[model samples]
Each structure stands twice: as C-alpha cells, then as structure tokens.
Target chain A: MQTESKSPLELEQCLKCSICTAVCPVMNNTDAYPGPKQCGPDAERYRMKDIRFFDESALKKCLNCKRCEVACPHGVKVAELIQTARRDMSQHGPGLREIMLANTDIMGSLATLVAPIANFATGLQLSKEVLHATVGIDHRRTFPKYAGTKFETWYHRHAAQNQGQFKHQVAYFHGCYVNFNYPKLGQDLVHVMNAFGYGVQLLEKEKCCGVALMANNMYNQAKKQGQVNIDSMRKALQGGVETIVTTSSSCTLNMREDYPTMLGIDQKDVKEHLGLAVRFISRLLDEGNVKLVWKEGFKKHVCYHTACHMARLGWNVYTLNILRQIPGLELDILEQNCCGISGTYGFKKENYELSQKIGSTLFNDIEATNAEAVVTECETCKWQIEMSTSLPVINPISLLAEALDLEATQKANIR
Target chain B: MKYNTVIIGGGLTGLVSGIQLQEQGQRVCIISFGQTLLHFSSGSFSGEESNTDVQALLKNAGIATVAGGYRLTPLGELRPAALTLEGYYHSETAELKEKSFAIVRLPKYLGLPIEFLQDTLTAQGREVSIITPDEVVGCPAEVILVPACKAGYDLKKTYGKRVSLIAALPPSIPGQHIHAKLQQYFQKIGGTYINGDKVVRSTLQTDEKGVRVQSVETQNLGDELIVADHYILASGSFQSEGLQSNYDHVWEPVFGVDTNAPEDRTAWTALDFFEDQPYQHIGVLTDEAGHALVEGRPVSNLYPAGHILGALRTDIQNLNDALRIAKNL
Candidate 1:
C-alpha cells in the first residue's frame, strides 16, 4: 500500500508578478492579508526552511476562495499553499467558536431535532446578541434556519420507495446546508433528475464535505470527513451509480478538488463521478440524448451570481446554460465577485466587517440589476447575498425544478 | 452550451474575433485556460495601415488608441505598429526621421534602456535628450516618453498629452489593463467567457463542408461538448499551451491539429539563446481560409487565428488575422 501524503506538496511556481495579489478580493478590501502572493507561494518558500516562518494570523485572513489559483497564469496552486500551511501549523486544538462552526454534522443533527426552537432562538434579536457576545458569531449575521425535516430523513421516507422503479440510478450528496437548512433543494434535485429519467438516491454513507471544518482550521477532522465522503462516492460509483450530483458547488469542489489537494485523500477514481446537478444534466442535454421540456409562461427576471467556489470550479457555465432554457426566464448573469462568505468565515465577528466590505461590490451589482431573485450554486453565497441585499438567493436547481415541465419533461426524456 | 461560434483562447485574437462576431449578432463563447500572453503584452498593439478597421472596433470598447506608421519598441527603436494605445510614443519609421524625443528617466524605475535609446536616436539623425519626469513641462522634445514599468500609474495622466510610453517585460500592469478591458467588453457585449477553463477535445464530423468540429469539450465541463456552428482556435502558441511537445514529437493538444515542425526534435532549437529557434515558428498548419487541419485535411468550421497561425503571423499581425476570419464569415 502506498503511504498517504497529507498535503499537496506542490513545488513553488509563483512568478512574483503580484497578479494573484491584484485579483485577491480580501487584499483589495483589507490590509490584514499580505495577499495571496505573500500568503501562499512566498510564505511557502520560507515555510520549507523553518516552521517558524509560517505566519498564522495573516494567513488566517485568506478567504480560501481559490481566486488566486484561478488567476495564476503559471497554474500555481496558490490556495493549496495557504491551506497546507494552515494544516501544518502546530495544532492548537480548535477553539469554542471554531468547534461550534466546524462540527456541522453534529450541530446540524441537534439543531434539526429542535429545528423550530433553534431557528426561533437564532433568529431572535435578543438571542442573536447574546450568542454574539458568547460564541463570537456576528450578531448582524442571520444563520440559515434549520429545516423542520432533514433531507435524508425526508428522502428515505418519501422518495426512496419510488427511486427503484427508475432504470438509471445516481446517488445524491446533499450537503449539510441541504440536509439541515433546506431539504427543499434536495427534493427539487430529485424531481429534476426523475423528470430526466434518472433516479436520485442517497449515498450509502454521507458526511459533511468538510468545507466548514477546513475553513475553521480543523484539518484533521476535515480529512476524516473527506475520506468518508470520497469512500462513499467511490462505493456508489462501484454500485453503478452514473454520477453523484450535488446541490452545493462548495461540496462538489471540496469532494473533487480540495479532498485530494488539502486532505491528500485519493479521490481520482471518483472525482469525475461527482459534480453539480447542472453539470450532468447539461452534458446529457448537449449530447442531444436527453431533453428538458420547459413550462409555459414561467417568467422571471433573474440574475446568476457566480460564487467564488463555483468560479474556481469553472462550472458556472453549465448552471447558466441550463437556466437559459426557461422560455420566459430573462437571464442576466451578474459579474463574478466573491461574496466574502467563505463557509463559516463570514459568521465570525472579526471577519464580519471585512466580509461585508468585500461583498459590497457584489451586493451593489445585485442592487443595480433589478432582478427579482438571485441564482447561485453555493449556499454560503446565498446567506451572504440574502443578508446583504433584499434579493432572495436561490439555487439554479431549485429554479429549474420550477421551470421544467413535469409531464412534458417526463415524456420527452422517457427515451 | 450551444452558440453560433465557440472560440478557444480568450487572448487578443480570440477576444477580438469574439467581439467582432458578437457585435454582428452571433452568440459567441470564448474559452481561455489560464491567463493569456496578454499579461506579457506591452499593452500596445502593432499592425499594418489596413488594421485601422479593427482599431475602430477596439475604440468602441472604451480602449484609447492612436495610429502612427510605427511605435517605440522597448529596445529604443521604431517598429511599424498599426494600432497604438493612446499615450504611447510613435513615429513614421522611415519618413519622419527628424523628430526629436525626450526619454524620461526615474530613479529606481530603471526599466528603460537609457543609453541605448539616446544612442539609437542620435544614430538615426535625430536629436534625443534625457530628462526627469518633472522636466516634461519645459522639455524641448516633441514627445515625452516613459517606460511602461510600475513606477507609478498612467504616464499620460501624470504628464499630459505630450507623454508617451513603451512596452515592458512580463506582468505589465498596462498589459493586464487592456486584457481586462477587452475581456470585460466581450462579456458586456453578451459573449460568454469561460476563464480558467480549457477545451480538451473536439467531436468532429466530416461531410461535404470538410471536417467540421461538431462540438468542443472543455476541461472543467468534461464530456459536455459545447456545440457551435463555427469554431475558432485562437488558443495561442507553445508558451500558452495551445501547442505542446515531448521528446518524441510536437503536437497541438486541443484538437490534435496538424502542426509543422522539424521531424527531429533535436533541430527544434538553437545552441545559442539569442538565435531564432525553429520551434518558435512551429505552429498549426492551416488552409488558405485559415481553418486548422487534422491529419492533413482542413476542418471546415475550425478557423485558426493568432500565434497558432505559425510563421505566417505578422503579436505583433494578431488583429489582422482575427479580423480576416470575422470579416470572411
């Protein structure tokens, strides 16, 4: 057996051009970050010489948005450099705020058990203030409310019985956001897939994709959860699941890219098997094998917000392409800007101000669009945009579910 | 995604061709892998007198340009540049040999060739003077020139209309500016740009129209073949990864288009660094219409533009070639 490597351990490929620095939204908004150049490759050169060369505080300011990686002409894994540095730093056990944010599955389960009480308490202004002072979550931030029913619980009860009747089966990795905060998105994915003649089932075992855990600097926990996710996806693929589609871009990115790079988990076999829902659907549509029937008079002036992870994933085009099919959908794609909410980073009081400042550019763009609602593939961006702007943020899959003709789609895609 | 045109590479040629097609009411998409050679540009463009047609298109996109027969190269010589960014020095390469120039020098911003510039102009039967940026007000030269290095911001803004600038080495801010501007213009005009994504393969169909690319799939979009009625391979040279090589052979990676290079890889380069290498001229073989070829046959809908057009390329006939394709269609 090959000994596992924990980090990407990539060589230094920075050209010292500051191009990454120019694109870094955090550096443009705040001085706390020395920028991606200094934070990633530059710091990496020193980190190799001695452990103390690692500057923890400044590196913590990185949104880990992967914008630097996307902008680098030399293809330097700039974000990987920053993440590996954070992963290697002497393990200070996670703090109270970090623990509360990082333990998504645990917190989500407990919150779902008492979802109404949790939502009420979290939404209450007085309770928000108390939690802000105690737990360090920003009082201005509104936590995405827990659902009355978890997606997995609802999936097993309502959808599981009907899934076996379909010939084509695929597993769905509805992440923590879809599992706890919104089961409606998971149900929508099921409906959209079923309409296309594909049955969506749950993975044999699913865990949080560990995006929040990694952002919280809980790398070890993130690794364990990443391995679990990859293993589950691999097993599902082995069981002849065509692919695993996710409603969350972050979960898809984390599973396909971050797992191998950040956690050093072997996901090559299952990497291509996982993607956002639109990616799979759009591919089939492009090949002219499957057809999606659209509803009549389903009109809405909507704009697509390319979340940072979705941009980094470079799959926003797939989502946008699928959305353009709605006959009356006057689709306007908003300029890509980071929403500054990199997982749980925006909820922390310290980053709350910087996060909002960085996201203001995007919020301003949204305000100018006069769009009825905002569509994005990332749930965190949904939180950030909804909190900052008056627009209700939605997933493309959710919009497609509404726009796709149920009876016509089922008939058209029956072949 | 389906479109009227799908062009690989979002560099100068790709964006220009995309913008031209987009303005003509064709749905266009340009897929770029990493940052293009645009980041390495002088932020200035050089072409022929005929290039003025395409120059006007750039002007509509908020790009400011001036045309002279020639432009000031980084090495302090005049070269024929069809279109020049406003605020950059230019001259008639041979006809206007008498105009004097004032090359501005700033401490710690020693990106310019101070001695070579003065000597070359003096050799060219013209008066050349070295002056500080502050002396631009009283300088006697016809043009106040500065190096396009990152000493500060735009020279024209600081020193007024008399000011001009020359190209710099890689990672020039002005280069990035123009690239960002053109890309923004392309997107603004409803052309979808897929940055940081590369076309990995093509689904080809050959009929009476020749080998047509039915669809082109990208790295990020995997098996999702982006179908287009017409395709353009503006994806740049070996440096930009439009073409790649191993010890065995040199080939175009994206479409496996036919490339012209020395059979022996050993003859690809020169022993000395300064010498022009054979590999530099190596690129995809194209038909008269500039469509890229596969297995020695022209792909009907696949048009090759920019540096991928090989030694025939006249940077530095990029706009002309792109305009040629756009105008033909």
Candidate 2:
C-alpha cells in the first residue's frame, strides 16, 4: 500500500460549515456520525489531540451523500475526502472491519459457497446484530435481501440473446453487489441498453471496486480495487468502445471521483477514457442518441429519489430530465437528503434505525407525491426505497428497457 | 425648487454624470424609481462582438473609436476614458482607465460572479475597463434588480452568498426576497442596509454645492426626501420608471430632461431573435463635454443616463459603457 505523503492537507478550507450537515439526511437521522462538519474538519482538528485510537466509526456513517460538496462554499471535495478517510482509518487501524471491508473477493467466494446460510442469517436479527457489532455497522438501516441467483448466471441462462431487439454493444460493469445479488437488474440493464441501441457485453472478469473496504476503513485495499477497475476500463478503451455504463451510483462515483485521486490511476489517456466510461445508466438513456419506442397511453407519475452520490455528481438532473422528457411519463423531482443506506452499514443491525430515520424525510416526500412508483438511478437507493416503501422502486434504465419493446407494440396495434 | 442639474434613473450612467456635474460644483439631483443593474451585475465591460461584421456595424454607428475603427485587430480595444465624444465633454477620468477589461462567456448553470469576473478581467487586460453582461443574457444595465429570465429563482436562492446588501427600495416589492436574502447575509456579516426610502428631488445641500436629492411623496407609506449635493441613480429602465419612455419622447424621470433618443420604437428591435440583438448601441446622446443632449441642445443639470438614454437600444450590452458614461457624468 502506497501512503499518500501529505494527506492532502485534510480539507482545511472546510470552515466547519453546518450547511452540509443541515442538508445531510444521515446526520439528521443518526447520531452514529456527528454530521458532516464534525466528521470532516471539525473531527479532523482533534486528530492532533494525541487521542488514543481514532473512533473511525464516524467515517462509516457517511452514505457518501454529496450534499456537503454541493453546499460547500469553497467547493471542498467532501465525498472524496470521506471515502479516502474511510480507507485511511480502516487500513491504519487494525480490526475485523478491516478484514471484512478489505477482503471482498474472499467474501464473494464465501458468499457463493454459503449463499443459503447467508440469506438465512440476513433474515435473523441475532445474526444481523452480531455482524453490526463485529463490523461497526449501525444496526438500524435495512438492506436488500440478496437474490439467490447472481446476475451473470441468470444473464447467461435467461437472456443471452440476439432477441432481434438489442442493437448496439455496451460495456456493462456489474458492480460486485449487482453481480452477486441483483443479477437480474444487471440483465434488465443490458436488456434496456440493448433496447436503446446497445448490445450488452458483460465484462464478466471485472472484480470488486473496494468500496466496501473503503467504507470499512481499508484505504489500501480500496485503492487496489480502484486500480483494478481502472485497468478494466482502460482495456475497454483500447477496444474502441466509448460508453461504460453501470447500475451502481457509488461504483461510478468511486471509479469517477475516487480512482484517479486515491490510486493515482488513470493517466491522461486513461483519464479521458475513464471520463467516457464513467457514465451512470440513466445518462446513457438520456443522451438523445438512442430512440426509445414510446409505450402509447402508458401513464405513471414518477417521483425520483435523488441518490446522494448521483446528486453530488450532478447526474440526478440528467436522470430527472430524461425521465420527464419520456413520452408517456410524468416526473416529480424529490431532492431530499441521504436515504440513510450507507451501503452495507444499513444491513448491520445498529445503523438500521438511523437509516430509516434519515430516509424518513424522503419517505414522506415520496408518499406526498403519491407517485405510482419511486424511480432512482442507484441500485442501492432502489433497494433501500423498495424495502422502506412497498411501492416498486425501479432503476430508470429498467423502466426505459420495458418501454422499448417494438414488436409487442406492433402486435398490440395489430390486435 | 428646481435644481441646477436634474439627472434621472439611479443607474451607473446617471450616478457618474451626477458625480461629474457635482464635482464641477454645479447643483445636481438624480431621481430614480427602483433598483439598479449594479446589484445583479457581473461587472466586466466589453465592446467586442463575435462577428467582425458586428464590430463594423458598431463603427458605422459612430460608437467605435478604436485604432482599427470597427475592424478590431488583436490589439484593437476601446479606451473609454481616453475617448472624448464629439470633441467636448470631459468629466473626470474613469478609475478603469488604467485597467483593460477582458470579455468572458459564463456557463448556463454557473454564473460569472460579478466580483470574480471583474477581478479576473482587470488582471488580464490593459488599463481602462468596462465590462457588461453580453447580449446572450439580455440583461440591461439599469438600476432595477429582477429575477434573470432563464433562472429567475436560481439567483434568488443565492441572494447574498458572497456580497452584502447596502439598501433596498419599496421593501415590500416582490423583489424583496432578493433584498431580504442579501440583507440577511449582509447584516449577519455586519453590512449596513437601508430600506423604504426614495430620492425624489436633488440639489446642492452643501456650500461647496454638490448634488443634493430630496425624497418625494408617493402613494407608498413612510417615504421621506433625501437631500444630498451628489446622487447616484441606480433606478432601472422604463419598466421601473428609471427613465420614462413615451410615443413622443424619452425622458429621465425626476429631471424632465429630454433624451436624445430615437423617435420611434421600431429602432428598439435590433434583430428579431433575442440572441443576435445589438440594441445596446441606441442610447441618450451626450455633448463632447458629456452633457445630456437633445437635438443639439444640452439639458442643463439633467443627465439622461442608463436605459433612459436613446442611443443604446439595449441596456444590458456592457457595464463598461455605463461606467464610462458614469465617469463622464
């Protein structure tokens, strides 16, 4: 692990402004982290106090929501700092959290081996509490139940098709969680992408981005993961492909924002390549390059939960704008704070309530909109929203995919 | 009760003209209605157009005074303080005369911060500066502050993120949100602010005889006249009554000074679409010594400034022009 020599001055210009905290849904909901200002420079200042062992648990509560970055006066890169800090604290300090966060590949292998037991354990409150206490996850937030079948296996079995529907080839990055748990969503992404003129090529060999490790406070492992993803992306660039779309907002943010700075990966050529590869799924759908077959008389009001990472990255507007412009769609924008699913943190028993409380504002807004369904670009947010509200929480790309069925419509017209 | 000089419209042009008239030890009063472009302005001044032909168009209009005339070579730029229009009007030299201004195009979502843009331009160019928000934005150099057309609510959300509010008028106008926000931020940071007052009539309140303006009675309550030897009218366009425009003539409000404006409204529409419009060239005429002129006659103590003037067809073209006009005033 290469240590960053200077630690980039620890964001001294942050001014301890509470504007970010005031807007932060996580801070509003959870006492696990004392808001962004305190977690950042306010907490960073006490580092010189000669305190025994930094309580890096504060770092884990950041849902990596970019609300602070948007509200910051000096435009401090808050999300990047938090992610970096998570990595730093995890690696520098020794713990079970480090092992869990750092060793995602091992976790994936073990997850596949004991898939049924893992699912069973996820259902039990005792297992969840044990995992949270052991891994430093606040046990209040709810996580998605892992699908028994991973995305790739299902894709090869059900969807490997020249279905005469998908036309262009797109490089799909099945983020670890999507690859292992929600593979169908990945398949749906490919199907929708194909419907929008892209033929799906699963970059099956891609590995973990170390985001979990970074969250677990393992910086070095996360950087390695970032480097691996960057190399994978670079290979796609050499293949002359331009668009790299992913269903994971955090994965994209990690690759787009964290990779270059943390790993020192993505040199000038790779940087440009990564920039092209760095788009979320909704951005691809909104590019106006693809023609979507409009579903006639399909009426639904869509309220968007602006995912934190996506909001900070400014892609939420692109998603909202595209959804609003869809032929048979009506979109109501909801810009609430974090959904309180700081990824795996919500799955832990401790963070569960905090996650729910932080997400309460969003839930209220969603209910007020009374939207037919809640739409989000991030898979994590989709899972969180679905678990919280019984309403269908869909990724925008999946909806667009369903909308692009030309033959079914022709048959309907013929009938 | 009449003053030696009456300038209307509380915009930069009237402010400068009044300052100049007052410095000459003449009696001056500037009356204005509400708001000025200065508050919402990104204060960079430029006369360059994208097309060389447009530059030629400016020259043909008799406003181009650069060395290349209308054909601005890379070196060609306007030096406003050095320019003596019609060979007579000389107020004081402008502060910007020592600094040349750079023209910058701001992005749609991001604004060109007025202070930042001014500093950046002044740092890059020669002496003598005036910069205005370009025609693309359609904002005029008037004293009225309204929501920008594209993102009216966008700026209101950030009313005083950086700057402080000094004063506001009508206090209850719909624009008070901007005033309130600016006031909140500015006052929180110890910036002084005044509200609910208007300058109605101005005269020399001092023995040295500077422009002194008295607040006049209006339908609105709690109005008092202000008396000052000099005045700055940041009051905006005809819509805000900074300058009164009618079928027969154009005039600055408090001064009753006739503007050397075009007789017809058709001259106001430079081009059809908003983007290509070059209406800023049409504004009030001034003599060589920078006196407001109407058909070759100078209106004594009445400065036709800001959008009230006829020579500038569009008020939002450039801030330097107003600054230059202000310097001359």
Candidate 3:
C-alpha cells in the first residue's frame, strides 16, 4: 500500500519565493541537483499533473536536511514534497547500496561480532575501492568503526547492575550509530543519567530510525522501521517508562516529527508517546532535573558544531545550556552550517567532494577557533567533523561523562 | 535553560539586540520560528534622518551603510530607502534627477517587465532606453539599471557608480545576504540561536509585585520550558504572525498581551488603499519601558520591539527601538 501524501495544500502555499533555494545547503554547494524550490513545490505541481515527469536521481540528491522547509515563510513542506516525489519515483525498488545503508541495524549487528577485522578491512584503501566498485560506497571516505561490543550487550552486562536503584526511569533509544559504531557514547549517557539518579533502560526492541532509508528513497522500508520502533517505544511506555530519550539528535527528530509526518503513523497515543522522547542530556539539563557535580579543574576549550538535525529540532539551546553548566569548560559555538555529511549522503562516491565543499566553511571556522575539542550531538556530525578537522570530535554526553565524578557514583552504587 | 535575555524572533531587531546584549556579557538566546521577514526585506532601512546612533551601531557590527536616499524599484520608479548596504546604488550619490539612464533587460529574465519599467521612468521625466545586456558594450547612456542577478559580481566595478540595481521583490538575494551576515554576527558574539521553534504559549508568574513571565513553551520539545530573566517580543507584525487576528478581534497569541487596536472591525482598514490603515497599527500595547501590557498593566520583564509595537514601519524603526531598549536593559 502506498503511504498517504501529507498535504497538497502545503504545496500550493509556495509563492516561488526562492527562499528555500537561498537556504538549501545542497543547492548552495552543487549545480547538478536543482534546488528545493524547483524539485519540491515547482516539480510537485508537474508531478500532480503527470507523474511521469518526476526525476528520481535528481530528487535523490536532496539531503532531506529540512533547512528548506524551515526557510519557507509560507509554511510549505518543501522537503516533504521532494521526499514524496522520490518515494513515488522509487516505487520499483532501490539499489543494493541503498538497501544496505537503510538496514543499518542488520549490517551493524553482523559487523559488531567481528568488529576489529571489519574495522580494519573497511579502513583499508584497496578494500574501500573493491567495496566502491561492487557496492557503490565511496572509496575515499572512511566508514565509522564498529564497536567491539554493542551498547545493548554492554548495558546488559555492566550498566544494568544499578537499574532499579532510581525512581525516575527513562527508556534510552540509543540509535544505530551508538548501538554499533560508538557504544561508548551510549555508556557515557548511562553514566551521566545514573549520576543524576535516573535509571536508563534500553528499549526492548528498537530498529534503525530510517533517516538513511528515507534519504535514499526507500520510503516504504523506512516506514516499516518507523512502525517497529514506534511499537517498541509504545510497549516501553506501557511498562511505566516516564519518558523516552535518545542520544542522537537525528533519532530524536525522527521519532518526534518524521514518524507521523513522513511515515504516516497517525495514531494519537503513539504520537503522544513519541513526543515524550527527548535528546537525553539536553532535556535533563533544560528541565533542571539533573544535578551535576563537575570534577574541579576539568578545563577544556571546546567548539560546538550544531548538527543540522539538532538545529532543525530546536534543541541546540538546550545543548548549549547544558554545556555551560560544566565548570571550567569554555565553549565557542561555531557558526551554523551543514557539516554536509548528512548521514550517508557524504558516504557515496558522487557526493564525497560536494559534501567536503559544503562543510568547508564549518571546517575553516573550527580551525580558526583552534579549539582543543569539538563537541556535537549527532554521531554522523561527530564523524564528519573529526574527519574534516584534526581535532577530536565528541558528543556532549562524553564531555559530561568525563567531568562527572564517576568515583562518587560508584560509591553511591555500592550502597 | 535560563538566559539573561530571551529574544522571541531572529529578525533584524532580535538578532541585533541579542548581539548587543551578548557583547555586553549577557547570556542571550533567540527563539526563532523560521525564515523571518528579513528574507523579504529590500536590503535597506529607512526612517527619520536623526537616527545616526543606530546606523553607527550597524556599522560597528560590520554592516556598511550609506546615507538614506532613494533607490530605483523593479518598475524603474524611485522609492525611498535609507541606510542601504555599501554595494547598492543610492540616488543620494547617483544624482539621477535629470539623467538619461538605460535599463539593461536580460534575455528571458522573469523579473520585472521592461515595458512597465520604461513607462514608469518615462512618466518620471527621465529619458529611458531599454537594451539587452550585450548591447551595453557601447551604450551612450552614462547610467544603467540592471536586475540584482549577478550573485557576487559588482556591476559598479565594470559600469562604475553610474550602474545601479533595480530592487528585486521578496526572497531577494541581497536580503538573504544581509540576513545571513546579521545571523553570523549574532552567533560570533556568543548569542545562542534556536531556530525552527515557535513560541507557543508563555508561563506567567504572579506575586505581590504583579505578574512577570516565568518561561515560554515551544511547539517542539514537549514540556521543556525556556526560561529567561527578560524577554523581547520582536516576533514581527501580522505578516510574520507576531499579531494574530480573527474576524472579531486581534490578539498577541503567545503571551495573550493586550493589543492597541480599535475593537470595531470596520475601523481596521482605511477607505483609501494607499493611506495609512488602522489594521497596520494593531499590535501589542507597550508602556514607556517597552514592556507589553496585560489588560492595562505592564508585564515588568517582558519588552516589545520591532513590528510587534504596531504601525511602525519595521525597516525604519526596528533597529532604533531594539538598540534603545537593549541599552536600557
């Protein structure tokens, strides 16, 4: 069954203002892809008249960053229209590379079992070339290294020891990146939450948030994953999970906004439960629910790269507010620009150069700051910034974890 | 969550005020809904000639501005513009009073109609000639007006100061350029900008000293409240939806602040379309302190600026009021 289109009224609202074109990062970087105004509402009008005119490959170039949507004063769902066009165009089937990128959970789980070998093989230039020739992954770009132990595995073995000690409970939705590539981020999140006397429980069964799938035009597969994740989250909520939390800003955005808007999961209860999901550390700090005792003399001058998803999600303020609470940490909030990795978009061979170009401004700004460390919430952004700059890029939770008095927490854990 | 000041718009006023406050060592955050009216602005600010302080402030912020004057519109008719960016040609320096100018109309250019522009210029007692861009190689006319199409190419460099750009309509490149610069400056000065978040409703704290806003609820992020010591409501006028009106009454939706408007609907619009309309004056009523009123009483910590102050042409008045209020704070 086809997913219902969001709204034609939204398409009609476009005044051909070109505001979307002005703000679109993808358009600003490359001429190969027509900007959002042309691909979104303008092409949408033609697609409504004759579906045959929809260009799949051109629409595929869209980063689905939603900057265009935010820039539209008339409230046109410009990104949605482009996504819809791509969905309709890809009705036949997606490519093998698209499928592999979309099902991150499956690849991630398999890769984690033999992570050291997998990481080494993917890191090798010849292997990357072979993979690129066969599977269309970029030859130059480095894939995120899979963790030796998945976050779920580590949580069950180690962090779950003090689960029931706290009254306030949160079901953590550690997205595919944290679960597979950087389980340490998830572990840091757990430590930070535990420091605040809140028990962090993993969702019983969670799938990939399908941001990659949606961008790659596998809308149906993305929707299925969305449903699975929604079901898992609902089950957790039924079991007395007060709130659901995600360490990844993109995952939080997917659950909160894209589930209903893009995936057509219009159930009122599920939507309400999805709304309860917040970016883990930022929400805790924003609500003043977390009491943090920073380890004295933990000084670091860090520059923050506001992830595109985090900026669009409107939670960068919370991230900034939380970061300021860390004693002796100086922060330089970098100018807002797309780091241009944009999940898997930067991973494809065709997009590699454009991605780097788009991210040039951000890289220059970071280098100019001469920051000791770069902090960002999205794992993809962390990878992108780290790859672009020599500086170590970390999630804000990791910084919080570093400053956290884990010894005091262990003493409390002993009780 | 709490800041020294929380600005509720990311337009010129909010950004400028936030930047000024941040430079003063105050923690500031701007909660913006989306692309502001700055995207539609004509890339200039106009008002009373006495407003040099704000112009100097803009200059300090790295926005080069020239003296206020007239600029040619897309129709070739001159319109009043003040304190324009350095690159734009102004009539104050152009001296177009009795000059013969050529309008370079590009081929298949979808912007302004050439005939209409010719008519307007001809009616204005100026000699006008229409020519394609290539014909400009040996044009006799000393001055030329071209569409602001060439992204970064300065027409003045090739054609000298005699070349001026016709003001494009909304979603203008010049406007977007200025907006990005302002936003970049704001962030550079240590101000936090929260974009794509609408201020839904505000929480009011009531005590013996009357009422003050405690926090504001945003559309996204469910129950997370944004707390600030002071608030600036520069959400803009009806075009930006800072003020909302139904068939019966107009109201400030966020804080439910009292508006200064005629209760009767008939008083909304003027009989003459070109004349000043009462509807334009419908906005949040503020006291001398620029604090928005709740019923008849002023909310101590809440200040109103920009178009939300009513009838004031935002381009003319926003920066002046924003800087003045920001200084007083």
- Can you give the TM-score per candidate against the true fold? 0.82, 0.52, 0.86
Scored against the true structure, residue A236 in model 2 reaches a CA lDDT of 75
User: Residue-wise lDDT of candidate 2 within A4-121, one digit each (tens)?
Assistant: 2234534765644344564566765545667777777666656546343346667767776667765453445666666655555454564675576446567666776678887787
lDDT of 2 by residue, B1-329 (tens): 12344444444454444444444455554443333443332111123322243233223333332211121111222233322111111123232232333332324323224444345434545332233233313332221122222232333344322211111111112222322233233222222122212444433222344222343322111122333322334445554445555455556655444454566767655665765533344344566654555445653333344554433333223233443444554
**Residue pairs in collision within model 3:** none
Tell me the spans in candidate 2 whose CA falls farther than 4 Å from its real position: A1-12, A15-17, A29-34, A42-63, A82-94, A101-109, A112-117, A129-143, A157-168, A271-288, A406-415, B1-329
User: Residue B212 CA error for candidate 2 (Å)?
Assistant: 40
DockQ for candidate 2, please give it. Answer: 0.02
Note the Cα lDDT for every prediction shown. Answer: 0.82, 0.50, 0.79
Using TM-score, give the best candidate's number: 3
The candidate 3 chain B region of ten consecutive residues with least summed lDDT is: B148-157
- By TM-score, is 1 or 3 better? 3
**Docking class for candidate 3:** acceptable
Q: For candidate 3, write residues B1-329 as lDDT tens digits.
A: 66899999898889888888887889898988778877766656756352677666677667777767877667665566767776665676434675677887776556667788888778877788988767777888757777765432345557666566666655676776667777777776767787878887799988999889999988765666778899999898887778877678888888988987898988999999999888987788888877889988889999999988875564757887888888878
Cα TM-score of candidate 3 = 0.86
Write one digit per residue (lDDT tens) for candidate 1, span A115-205.
9999999999999899799989999998989998999999989999988878899999999999999899999999989988998889888
Query: After superposing the true interface residues, what Cα RMSD does each candidate give?
Result: 4.2, 21.1, 4.5
Lowest-lDDT window of 10 residues in candidate 3 chain A?
A: A271-280
